[model samples]
Target: MSTSRHPLRGDVLGEQPEAMAAFWRLYGLLWSHGTVDQSIKEIARLRNARTTDCAYCRNVRFAGARDDGLTEDRVALIEDGYETSTLTEREKAVIRYVDTFLHDPAGLTDTQRAELLEHFTPGQLVELTAGVALFLGFSKIAVALGPPPGMPTLVVPTPDWAPGEAQP
Candidate 1:
């Protein structure tokens, strides 16, 4: 079967089907089952997408997030100067978390950690951290492997995959 514009699958699946399957399984789980709200997670994910400049990542939106009220207008603030944007405090915290998580996890300060904990349980924090880690790692690989053809921003069902399949 054709890869359906999923570059990560084309490059990584042949040699690492089990691992890729496991990763996508986790992706599905992150979307399907989590303590944190899907909308919040989407905010963080979008922030990562922009910071990484992964065009494919930037163009895809999660259905769960959208259904939970993540509007395109809100998504636009995932860029620089979001701190000054009219985003809610909760949304701002999510962006901060992603920026720190992506750029310098070790530099995470006491205040930042406290702010995140204010809006998240420790378990939620774990989930958010894992999600961003997956996002950053997978998005980079997808971009580096040669991106799929470009498309306008599209809403996709949250990703899931069988052991040997391409992604959405």
Candidate 2:
């Protein structure tokens, strides 16, 4: 279905106003709370969106990232090769943590935690951790329910084959 035609208007917010309110309440705090760099948070957010194949998540513009001092060049490199890109070691560490968290939460090791500690305070770590978990759930919801009607995105993905197709 077109995202606009989604049953729940594509956004859980419209169907479950209370839940969205609670979600945004927490999300608002995570956006600028704690000592973890805003740039790191943006990178983590973008990385989660890309890994989940949620076009809606990917399409939302992150003005915050730019405001946090990330250059367009750095933001552009987030999709594929961020590990080897021009990002600093600290930024790369945040990406690695988010990647591992999304793919395998239990796989996070003390070594990785220690690395994060080198850069983030204990409170910042909590904030970053919560943000990662929130987006993990958020991206899944967006992928399943699709974007809300009239929501803007950079580009929406198209499937190669429809639901029914003749055998090759």
By lDDT, who's the top model here?
1
The residue-level lDDT of candidate 1 at 144 comes to: 78
- Where does candidate 2 stray beyond 4 Å? 1-6, 10-12, 148-168
Clashing pairs in 1: none
Worst 10 residues of 1 by lDDT: 5-14
List CA RMSD, all candidates.
5.0, 11.4
> What are the per-residue Cα lDDT tens digits for candidate 1 across 1-168?
466554344465457766766777788778777777888888888888888888888899999899988899888877887899988888898888888888888998999888988888898888989999988998897677766776589998866545555654
* lDDT for 81 (candidate 2): 81
RMSD of 1: 5.0
C-alpha positional error of residue 155 in candidate 1 after TM-score superposition, expressed in Å: 0.7
Candidate 2's TM-score reads 0.78
